[model samples]
Target: MAVHPGDSPVHVALRTSDVDEARAFCRKMFYGPLQVNPVGDPAGFAFAGDVVTLGSITVGEISYGADVRVNIADLETAYHVLAPLNGSLWSRHRGTVVIADPTRAAVYRPVGDIDLEWPGDTRLLSVKVERAALERELDAALDQQIVSPLLLGESFDLAEGRGRTWSALVRLLHTELCAEEGLASSPRMAARWRDMVVSGLALTVEHPYGDEPAGLQGPRRPRTVKRTLDAMHAEPWRQFTAADLAAVAGVGVRVLQEAFRQHVGVSPLAYLRRLRLDGVHAELSRSDPWQVNVSEVAYRWGFTHLGRFAGAYRARFGVSPSQTLRERR
Candidate 1:
């Protein structure tokens, strides 16, 4: 149940036989102040794990040699996913019990207490995403405010559909970061990978907005919609807010929003984001990666947040911004 063959390319962050030391390491690295108790002989207990920080996300491969029970009171500012590589994991979150294995994973939100039972010799790929980062990605995707404490399913299936694809993306991230010479060294590439992981989870897991369609096709464009579109296309790099776009269309913000939804199938800000993404793509396609990195191009197109930009770019273009830059033809 190893995450890698032989030895992992990612350096081990912690390896200890003392339960106190292991608990301290987990507190500092993954979660804050949790209780870990051995389920079997204390003498057989051991801990080994590797951890890496990618922007607002933390990825780790962890294993406790003996069976143990973990009690976490609150995750506070982050969301967690524990996907076992070999043995199954028993997790209780929000009053539901889930037996997570290779085919299924456990997801914990920021608000609730989590109890987990790890069987002997179980290895797990652990992902921690900051709450703000994940929620921002969701907000951007839905173009609206998200309800607090997102109702994510306690158990996620990793054997089919988007869950399977998300699992593969997580493994790929692990592999790249573990490699000696991988693209993850670049900040831009790391940001892109982090966004992919967060966005993938948002799309894969059961949530309020999960059932919404990708886009809505509406009727023909009106004059106000046409004016707003012209303004956005003409100055994609300008920092145009909803009020600014509405002003350009000679209407109130709500009227402009309704008009855009009726004609463009998205809000003015969302359509403007699409325009900015297109600008970045066009610039990256012609620029050399060695001379100009993805961030510079992204920033030039009014993308202040690299993680959100990467998620939006990939959602629109089916590839990362760095990939578009590297594979320019």
Candidate 2:
């Protein structure tokens, strides 16, 4: 997936029962160089294959003949990060253990040699995102090549048991994916699909180098920063202050402040506030105008103070809540 930051999305989906065909696609993508070391002899570990259909948002329609299992090294160098649409995968890379089962989500960087495996039967969706292009997409920490594997490196799983907001983000993407995917027709049919692809990619490939902790990508840890981040995520719109955060994290106010600065790249308040915006965006993105109330939507995301919320919401999203609600219909 050679990416141009502003370039649209390229989506590909494949299901193949033939190991040869699946392996071929993997080879074309990255597994060849990675040289997957299967646990047992191929004849022994191999399971029934799938009826494969390769779908694309870029490069158009490409057909595949069989189901495949593959292994590769230094994936971050080859493929751009493609967000996981469904299912689970187990992989190890970059001295980290990654277990991505979108329901729980496993994301890691394969800086060193890595091992990856696939489920006996799986349906996966991939969107090619070029790091070079992502630089143009936004000014996030992703401007540099993310060595963090799983998200972009060879292939890894999408873990499960994410915090509430992350879970909500998946629900939105899954909804759009199920509704418009089969009828996507062409690569660039509508912005909603593009938004779906981008949003999913951003949330899933979250790296710690920028503002998050070194491994805040998804493993369950009990550090104060981890607890603090999760707490803010749990209550994005809360009127949380630094002192309040320190109490939640069980650290001195200054210590927690420094930790947030070093790990998350932003102050605690800033992180929480941004998450609030994301929360609102997720709600608006998924809300059905015919069924949901607009003001109630704002209030739900902690926008009870109308004017301030409207201004902040408009500034963050480029569109007013009214416009967002109308479009949701």
Candidate 3:
């Protein structure tokens, strides 16, 4: 259903009878390049869309007045969710098919080929999140490096529990953003709202880490683990070997490794790499793109191999180092 014009401030509004114009608007505002074809009579085609953008997130209410088929080769740089407010949607992605209705939302990952069938009666509340932004939020919440692709389940439940909560939050965010002087008008508040939405999705959707217990406290750190962590945090720029960290903890390498495994989820070197990556991210976030180089920053954070570092960085943050550097603040 289209948002009432006077009720919410729409960043992009479309009410057109031309299919090409509707397709072009969808390309510009949401997905990149895609194809839209009417399933029935072309002469009966009508499209209505109302959208609001909040930083890396875009939420929209959209509908096609006639049945249509949409094909997208790949989303490329974002994750999308389509929750129908009424009627149903048929979607196929990565060999999986889902019929999405009000209780079920179709989730599309960045890497897949997608095909969708939209009946004339359906209207959708759609959410789009930039790949990097969502990945970064997942990393912070899990306190570890996330694997690439971050594969998500084809369908998300919106009838109860966390999924229902997240769905409500998305609608609230859309409404607030649509207001001319809502809470999201402030940059800081807007960021918090964006984080809440992404974080909610990450927690609600099924993924590789879905089974991990939430808020489970790890074992308390003993003195040796604490000492080693202090040393690493103090000089993350230092090129440290396992033996060196063991020496700093006043324990043998084997003993230190076991302690790290017990108290920390990762090994010592892995922890060091995480620390270094965090340092690089902080520097890139504050450094001016014109005055800084991503490689130099990587080196400064003790990332000796450029290729491996870039891969790890993208795996953890879901974007290239240069992209992060350029989009600083």
Candidate 4:
């Protein structure tokens, strides 16, 4: 789990000491029931001075990855960044995630399970931060009032991997915490680490170069795009169209399309569809299924076209919407 605030982001350095204790801790941390059967004994140990970690295989209920599990404390925000200096690890963020390796890295939000497994051994860093910590750190660095549980994106720059100071700092901190002593007092270390980290992140925020999406107005937009996004967010169940979006955004159809395309990367319709699909799928997968059935949930989310909705849901989440229903029992 990755945390932000300078002193409070939970930075834990765990050593593979007692396998039983480690497994139990993993179950508690990663949000999974204790495995009935252990997968591997980490055949051999690696003497990597960086930080060595024992690996395991995940079986049974596979919501995401089998290897790693995380359980977060309330008022705490967790972020997991796997720079996989090792071989490769499977990652699931929103839908069906891809495998990340040393050559590349991926980041997960405050919520979500992360996994890593290989035949032999592996090592990676897990970060956890209390919400207050992340908020205070980011606010101090950015000089802006930032809200808690602020969602740091899962996106990263591969071409610029390990090139920037921010990226390097993460590696250094995670690596150093790999010792028994390091993990024993990770919070203390993390506080200092968060201090340095917030400084770097603040520097990036000030520079505001290639960090966020292109054409990002950074608290500003073409008014039309802003209005359109607000409306869609307000009522996802409405019949939305380009003209409708244009009207709400206070612009013509062409301008609406251009503004959305420029600021948001996708066209208005595509963006709306993405939003609706994300909402509906999230309702299905993450929300309490007891409150609604598949079809009813779909309708509530404005998915009149069942086939189209199912297809989009499957494409995004790697499973059918009904699967969520089936698993409810």
Candidate 5:
């Protein structure tokens, strides 16, 4: 379904009476060689679902009329977070079992195979994130390559604190997605939303690298931070990696990262993201809404995910990019 980094989204809505058709749809949408077995009588079996994509992440809702068991050899390239909207789901990922409902959400890491049993009335709001994108975000945050597999825990508590906040964000995205034209439809917004989803997953889910220090051995320095900021302000559109910024600052990546946190109150990449966000805001504020799409201006400023970009823009400016464009118009 073109669920890759930097690709346009593929939207799908499917309802079928045949189990085989549902199985094929699941395999194609999730990129998993999955086996679906109805747990009970198939006489009244039915499947209904719809999915919306944002770059390498797919957010969707699905339900079945007949209870079923799903088996997968390996979800080789992606990680899935399934939060049930109604009913229940029991899952085992490489032997780690979790019960998924409204309060508890299931997290399936990329390296493991999975088995799931869904009740006949089970309905889920699923978030599927690409492995490469997750690793790339981690690499950017750490400023180093990660060679080991990232094994996340089986589930997270969605009833309280950060997990609840994350779920709310997901719901907000779903709401904006259903709008005829809104931030979720903008490329800039999707970029920011994608970043939030991946980053949020890493923060909320238990992973090995979650607590690892992200800075260098030496003390933080403002000069290094200034250098990185200068580069970002000069060329916010450049795909500048942590290594590249470190090179420009005449320091190691971790050192530059620490400098940014100490002096700028954010990491180097985050500073760059802010600059890009500002660029988008400025463009939207000056453009006519009818003549320019928020996605176009966001892409021009180097944003690739509309949902994320819109969320960040709203958080920063207290309004959506489209709102800014409309006011300007």
Candidate 6:
């Protein structure tokens, strides 16, 4: 998927006193249907908020002036992290219920139905992540095949330590997206930021596979390692996740990671990234500087951040990317 210049950092705001209009707006903003009912007099109800789409993730700030109840059959293709900035939200998912207040946030997975209740004067900050992106990041981080949609624990602590860091990152992303012509407007930077959020969530959220053991305990399979490497080099442009490479090798992610470390001297993802960097170097050597920019060439080969790309390029080749481009020019 090529990113258009104006695709990211898109912001939309809606404010209304009608409950039906509020429900419809929520559905349209998040791409899911919802049943919203007022808990009190409809005349006293009001909704106000803005949602910003940054890359594949959507960040929204919403508020309701009166108590309300909402039911959704399924989120289908997205995962949401809902944190209350003020007031409170009671959320139920897969039989577990949690009150998401200032210190506790709710992680809503894509597979199950969701029910939420908002007290009068409640306000929330939400991060909506694409399901595929989240899954791919998790698989890559764990180096294993995830059999189904992730079932995260109900409440996430936001007041201390890891939770605090994660919450801060979200706030930073939200602030940047709301800025005028933010860094998200740059394709490379946007991708890097999006990856940060996805990877951060994978590490922060509590999951069943969080404690999976690493490395092969028995004999290492050389054939499996070779097969995985061959597949990686065959199509370096593809966004190959750990699960994808593991499937190619016919082994689990931990086994694949161990195999590569024993035989290839690097992890599977690292090897793949090295191949991509090499491809970027070769392309830069062949293209004209007059027509090609470093960011364009780097992005073409899946290098998302320009700063990181430059550092890696220099570390690998002992020359900056611009120096290479100058040689070709």
Best by lDDT: 3
Clashing pairs in 3: none
Per residue, candidate 4 scores C-alpha lDDT tens digits across 1-329 of: 45433333232224443445555545555434334222444333222222222111010111121233332222124444455545565565544465656555555544343443432334443333334544455544331223234545443543363324565776665545444466424555555565565444433322211244333235545566767777877887899888888888777999888876666667878866766776665566555666678888888878898998999888755668887555444
Cα lDDT listed for each candidate = 0.77, 0.49, 0.80, 0.51, 0.75, 0.76
Provide the TM-score for each candidate, comma-separated.
0.62, 0.41, 0.64, 0.64, 0.62, 0.62
Per-residue lDDT for 1-329 in model 1, tens only?
22212122233488899999999988888787589999869888879878877767788888989999999976868988998888999998755688999999999977546899998779989998888888777766653334445656787889888888998898888878877678875556666777789888887787643343132112335778778877776777899989999899899999999977755567889877866776786677667678999988888889999999899887755568887676543
TM-score of 6: 0.62
Model 5 reaches what TM-score against the true structure?
A: 0.62
lDDT of 4: 0.51
- Please give the lDDT score at residue 196 for candidate 1: 86
Candidate 5, which ten residues in sequence have the lowest lDDT sum? 212-221
State which candidate, 3 or 6, has the greater lDDT: 3
Per TM-score, what order, best first?
A: 4, 3, 6, 1, 5, 2
Candidate 4 error regions (>4 Å): 1-17, 24-79, 90-97, 106-115, 128-166, 175-219, 287-291, 327-329
> Residue 143 in model 2: shift from native, Å?
12
Kindly give the number of clashing pairs for every candidate: 0, 43, 0, 17, 14, 0
Cα lDDT of model 5 by residue, 1-329, tens digit: 22345644457889998998999998888765789899868877889878877777888888888888888765657888999888889998754678899999998865446789999888988898888887776666653334334546678989997788888888777666656587767666767776788777766776533243253223333566656666776778888889999999999999888776655567888877867876786566556677899988888888888899899888755567887677554
Who is ahead in lDDT, 5 or 6?
Answer: 6
lDDT by residue (176-274, candidate 2, tens digit) is: 444445443233443445544444445445433352324324542338887887677677667777899999999898888787676667777776666
lDDT of 5 at 319: 62
**Residue 234: error of model 5 in Å?**
35
Candidate 5, residue 195: lDDT = 72
Worst 10 residues of 6 by lDDT: 210-219
Please state the error at residue 106 of candidate 6 in Å. Answer: 0.9
